[model samples]
Target chain A: MALDTKDVAKIAHLARLEVAESELAHYATDLSNILTLVEQMDAVDTTGVTPMAHPLHMSQRLRPDAVTEADQRDAFQTNAPATENGLYLVPKVIE
Target chain B: MHDQSIAELAEGLRARRFSSRELTQHFLERIERIDPTLNSYITVSTDVALAAADAADGRIAAGDAGPLTGIPLAHKDIFLTRGIRTSCASRMLDNFIAPFDATVVERLAGTGVVTLGKTNMDEFAMGSSNETSYYGPARNPWDTTRVPGGSSGGSAAAVAGGLCVAATGTDTGGSIRQPAALCGVTGIKPTYGRCSRWGMIAFASSLDQAGVLTRSAEDAALLLQAMAGFDQRDSTSAREMVPDYSAGLGDDLTGLRIGLPAEYFGEGLDAGVEASVRAALAELEKLGATIHDISLPNAPLSVPVYYVVAPAECSSNLARFDGVRYGHRCEAPKDLEDLYKRSRAEGFGDEVKRRIMVGTYALSAGYYDAYYLKAQQLRQLIAGDFRRAFEQVDVIMGPTTPATAFELGAKTDDPVAMYLNDIYTIATNLAGLPGLSVPVAPVNGLPVGLQMIGDTFAEGRLLNVAHRLQQATDWHRAAPADPA
Candidate 1:
């Protein structure tokens, strides 16, 4: 229940964020405080309640499979941090 | 002319009293002179707005002017604007621009409102105070050393400072109403899915509802009518009919049953704020409205549940900002994991990183049932409280915030303290109901907003009640002296 620096390190990795080793204790304290706050839910007796996923009770609407979007590679590509030959560039996963 | 309401301004345009170009120029001059101290605007498209104003003038000359024609206003940066930088006040999207417009922006433009560019907001709409914004905190117009309650702080300040006639704001948990309360403006967040979320940046999609901050309830009505409607693109958008919001403003509140929740007025509520809210209730009673004391027993758990649900959803939504496709990327990644980790760390602020980590931890292995699932179950009970309360009354009344706007950097070090600022307003969001804030009075020289919570799809009624109050009082007309 208590989140220490080790827990903070693990969470940072899972979240794909790099946290400096020295700052882990600070985050741990904050996250632990937040967790303590969230523990208030246990006070209520939610014996058979269903978790409300969305605000409304409506089911997701389904549409027939079709391509409604137009190709905007040029426009979309403009926002890419790194691109070459119409493809986004990232570090290669394969050696 | 700057103090005029949307309806009055529309009349002036129709009567040829002032051209849209002249109106736009006036606001531009004000923004130039006043915004340096207030820091309300992020991007101001001067040339584009002038050109749009000219086009609006042509529409007026040809007799095609709408209520919002040539009305220069600002959009919260959360809403996407085509070719305009729509930074969600985060460095991750500081240089990000979408090729299209958000549904709210598209719809508002369809009604002929000129854009004065985007206003600042709490980064990714996460923080209670706008201090988390990358552009720095927006000072309250009422008191320059204080904060304009956020994440719609800039919009609220813009409206209060008369930098713009009105502006768009998105409320996840009291973002619109809290700022409205602090800045002395009228703000309303309609029921979830009442406005399309297609172009609005996602921040807890289920709780985010597009709304407006304006000088008066009537002005809010005029803007909301244009913003609300169904859009096929947004899967959650409702099929309900958009009504004439302005038409119902003069409706009588003779038989209105306003409920005062006991939980809302308890400990932690400032004495000055409670007294101001009580005065507003007394005024409403004089108009034949009856007050019923009610109890939303589960309201206290709203902050806890929100931190869980919002962060959990944010983790999922923000995962798309990996270093690969768009947004900020690492300089030279050794590999994929390093690219993602370093890019996200470098791009995001401390609060953002903390939330993402918390969210990941909540939904992580073995903790999902304890954190995310439990929060959702508790969410049902909190929402149930509103449902039961609504069964007994037409609307619920309370303070918009526990206190008026606090000093800049006052609660910055204490996250929980900042989170509790929304205690009175978060339950409405959790219930997915429409809520509004009407400026009632100033407490300690800072504005206080009396919050009204109506049943789902009751925007018209909320606006009507707020409109009635404004007609009888000049509290909404209070503005700071020349934006400090």
Candidate 2:
């Protein structure tokens, strides 16, 4: 279950992180070590065990489709890296 | 005055022996003088603290004071504080000012508490030691060269150093208790959902819990009483009635059934730490408590399961920080793709990037069943172990950490080594039970915390058990001198 540098590169891409080419091998080693540790789970017999998503075994609490929040756009935009005309500005998505 | 208990300080304020303003000043002055060495605070809001202290003074004058009124404390930077920089110690939000206070912050403020400022923590609450903080690691007050275990390291260090009366900390895995153990303070992580996570930065949502670190369990109870409750804003917040956490402090421990999990005391547990925990158990026995051996067969697998589940949740939660609405953005990007990738890479640290990678891989197509689903199944096994153990015992007792605080950079290079730092404490989080740590004894003058794990929402009982130990021993009161 050792992840090679190529696997690490693909993971970095999938995760939307730009790992430097030089650091890919380093991350590969680290991730492989972590995966090795995770391989310990293989010893446990999880047959017929349901995958638990919540700690309290509770389902997601649903709320009414009502907007309970105030429009604090002006306040929130203060922390934005870039914004214009009440909308967040990122690099042009469409050519 | 700085070393006095919260009750003592509150009494002083009520009797006008000292004003809240004066108490705040004393702490501010101490932080100014001492924090340079400890690096405990990310932001020291002197003006805010003084103003709140004045307001507390007014409340006292009007006979409108509660238990924590006028007591000054710090929030781990992971909790949002409006108008103040809430850098979960990550470069991504290094400049991000929270637009609103976290629910815990608001609740404590409602109790007329004075805030000292935001304390430092592991960046995004991801590391076992404070080393991952963008600001810098908070030094252990007991030994300057050593680390204060994290991601709540700064809070523990601040309280241990007498820089603040107490501090708020979030525990995902062993964040609060591990640091408290290393720093010789009291800390508790109540049952998940017991405290609203509104505005508290999300780490592993299912695992993260807000708690307090204080000089003693009594102070922890006082602060926790102010901080715990439900908030509609937090959908996962519990609707359970908040109890008087301090009510059980003097309750007798007679006939208390304590479970000792042999898995926790096995190999890798330092002899000294085990000795100290055993000594604390003896003290409880003297108090009329009975200890029984119990088995949590699945407990050993907690660290592995936690690494998988926590990172998986983190990967999903952190997707919001993609150079978009807020947080760090990259330099002029050629296009949208470049913007996201570069901003994230530049914004996150090595450990954060490492986790995101592990998480992405786990949730990816081929590995999902083997890693993510398998981890979840094992998680239930781990939780089930706690459930059955609680049936036979009122509480489970063990050492909070396998060893005392290691030197900074000791485990920084080894990810697995750092992850194992939390092996004993991670199971409680996986089980979503209330767990608390009290200073049992110091091993080689470094602190050893005796952890008590109770059933869900049993925070009061945990605090009471911790409180009784503090009464019987002076270990919790042994504050570290100024670290050179």
Candidate 3:
């Protein structure tokens, strides 16, 4: 299960991160080492064991449908990188 | 004043010997003088601290003070502090001022605790050593050349250095306990859901838990009592009632069943660390506790399981940090994809990028079951080991780390070497059990920590055991020589 540079590049793209060409080899090697470490899990017999999602056994607690938070758009938007007319600004996706 | 415990400081405030403002100023001055070498604080809010101190004084003067009234503490930068910069020790959030307080911050503030500002941490709590921090690593207070175990390194160093009475820290995987051990302080990562996660930046939502680093177990109990409880805002917040942690400090450890896991003392454990841990167990035995040999067969796989699970969760959670909404943004993105990719690449550090990629790979279409699902199932086995051990023993005792603090840059080049530093402590996080690290003895002039693990919501029992140890030995009282 060795990870090559192509595999590293594909994963980086999936993660929405742009890795420099020079760093891809480094990442490939590092990711391979990590995979080797985790590959030990494959040896464990997990028959009939339910996958633990959350550490606590409780199910998600639901709240009543109501307006619980005050609108703070102006305060929240102050930290945005770009905004116009009460909306976040991103690059144009439309042709 | 800098060396006083939180309880002692609260007592002084009640007696009017000194106001909170005076106390805050004393610590601020110490930070100004001492932090240059330690690099423990990312932000020191002098104005905000003084203002909060003034408010605390008003409460004391009006005869309306709680146990933590007028005491000052540092936050681990991961917790949001309104109108103050919360960097999480990353360039991404370098300029991000939190719009609201984290539940831990709000609760402690309500108890009249003054803010001493945010401490440094590993970026997004990703690394074991503080070296991964965007702002340089926090140096160990005991020996400036070594690291204070992280991502709660700054909190550990601050308390150990006497710059603050206590500080807040979060442990996703031994972040609180490992650093506490290396710096020779007290730190506890309570059972998952013991503290609310709302507004505390998520690393791995399931594993991440907020806890405290302090000078003594009694101080940790006092602070944890204020921080733990249910919060509706956090979907995973436990609905259990919060107990009075300080009330159980006097409970005797007689007849206590302590489990010694043979797997923890196996290969890679430093001889010096092992000796100190054994000595600590002997002391507990003299206090009428019984030690039993136990085995957690799957314990060795904890680090691998953590790397897969934590990174997978981090990859999902960090997707929100695109260039559009907030945080570091790349300039002049030609397209939406460019905006996202470049902004993230430039904003995140190497370790963060590594994890994001690893997580994305684990959760990818073809490898999902082999990596992610198998890891989850193994997580259960690791947790099951703890469940079986707890049935026979009241608590588990071991070394907090395989070795004491290592020199900076020693293990940075190899990620696997760095990951093994937390091997003994990560299993507790995976099992969602309460774990604490109390300084036991100095090995080769560096401190070693004796770790105590308890069942879910058994924080008071763990604190009681740690409290008893601190009462009998003066290891927690040892401090570094003056920097000046």
Candidate 4:
């Protein structure tokens, strides 16, 4: 169950984090240790046990399709890193 | 005046002994003077606090005052405060001013409570020792070199250090109780959904719960009464009616069935902490309570289960912090993918990055059923253990932490060692039950906390037990020798 640098790199990529090459060794060791600690779950027999998503056994409460919030694009976008003409700006996706 | 209980402050205000403006100014000045050493506060809103205090004074004059009217307190930076920086002790939110108030903030403000400031916390409420804070670790008031248990460490330190009357804190996995134990204060994490989590920044949605830290359990009850309720904004907020937490404070413990969990007292418990907890139990026995041996067979798996479940939820919740909308952004990203990856890499800290990776791996294609699902199933086992134990006893009692506060950097290098610090308190979060920590005694001049776990929505009972303990002992009144 030990995580090597390659596995750490893959996980970091999936998580959308740009981990430096030098830090990969550190993360591999740390994540491996954490995985080892959590590996204790394998010892328990959870046969036929239901996987619980919430503690209260409650389902997601649904609301009507009506829009309850007012448009405050300017206020909400105040913290955005990049924005122009009431739209968030991102790098070009098209080739 | 700074060390007085919230109730005492309220009485003094009603008696016209001091104006709310004066009380607020006293705390503001104390923070300016004392917080440099403790690093407990992230922001001190002087003008906003004074204006609120002035309004409170007007309310008092008009005979519209409530129990908490004009009382000054601090909100943990995790809760959003409009027009103020809500850092959550992370560099990502360093410049992110919340556009609206958290439900907890709105509710407490409705009570005419004056907010002194926002307190520091572990980043995203992730760490057990406040060392992960981007601002800095909140020092334990009891011993400056020691850590105040986190991620509610700032709130605990502020209350214990007499910098504020009380403060709001959120518990995901023993965040509130563990810090309260180490800092010698009172804290309670009510049943999940007891308080609305609308604007309290999400960590582990299922495990995150908002509570309060105060010098005494009576003050905790007073603050919790204002902070707990249902809201339509939070879908998971319970529709249950909010009770008068302070009303039942005087209930005697005669015939109270207290369960001493065998798993909690078994091993890894420091002898000093165990002795203090046992001594606290003896005091409860003298108050006519009966202690019974109870077993929670799955309790030992709590720490492992939490690491899996909490990190998984955090990974999902934090995905919103990409470079596009808000939070920290990267410098000169070459493309869209670079924008996301570099921004996140630069924004998050080592522990946060480690958790994100761990969570991503756990939820990945080949491992979902093994790690994620297995953890969920084991979660139910832990909850079931609590359900069965509650059937036999009214409440479960144990030490809040295995030991007193450790030195600031003692376990920072080892992740597992830090995780085990919360071993005794995480099970209650996994079970989604209410828990309270009350200062019992000082071992080697460091405070120890006795934890009481109750069934779902039994916060009043937990507070009542803590209040009775405080009445029988002077531990809660023992302030730190050094306010610095």
Query: lDDT at A5 for candidate 3?
Result: 92
Which digits, one per residue and each the tens of the lDDT, describe model 2 over residues B91-159? 999889989999999999999998899998999999988999999999999999999999999999999
CAPRI band for model 4: high
Which structure is stronger by DockQ: 2 or 3? 3
Task: For residues A7-91, write the lDDT of model 4, one tens digit per residue.
Answer: 9988989999999999999999999999999999888999999887787867778899999999888998999998999999998
Off by over 4 Å in 4: none
Chain B TM-score, candidates in order: 0.99, 0.99, 0.99, 0.99
Pairs that clash in candidate 4? none
Task: List the candidate 3 regions with Cα displacement exceeding 4 Å.
Answer: none
The CAPRI class of candidate 2 is high
Model 3 lDDT tens row, A1-95: 79999998899889999999999999999989988888888788887889987798887667789998999998999999989999999888998
Report how far residue B126 has shifted in candidate 2, in Å.
Answer: 0.8
True-structure Cα RMSD, model 1: 0.9
Which residue pairs collide in model 1, if any?
B102-B199
Model 1 spans with C-alpha error above 4 angstroms: none
Residues B1-484 of candidate 1 have per-residue lDDT tens digits of 7899998999999899999999999999999999999999988989879988999999999999999999999999999999789889998898988899999999998888999978988998888778999999888998989999999999999999999999999999999999999999999999999999998999888799999999999999999999999999999999999999999999999989999999998999999999999999999998879999999999999999988988898898899889777788889899999999999998888888878887889999898998889888988999999999889999999999999899999998877788888888887888899999999889878899999999999999999999999998889988889854
C-alpha DockQ of every model? 0.84, 0.88, 0.89, 0.89
Q: Under the 3 Å rule for N, CA and C atoms, how many clashes does model 1 have?
A: 1
**CA-based DockQ, model 3:** 0.89
Per-residue C-alpha lDDT of model 3 across residues B258-280, encoded as one tens digit per residue: 99999999988999999999999
- lDDT tens string, model 4, B17-81? 99999999999888888899999999999999999999999999999999999999999999999
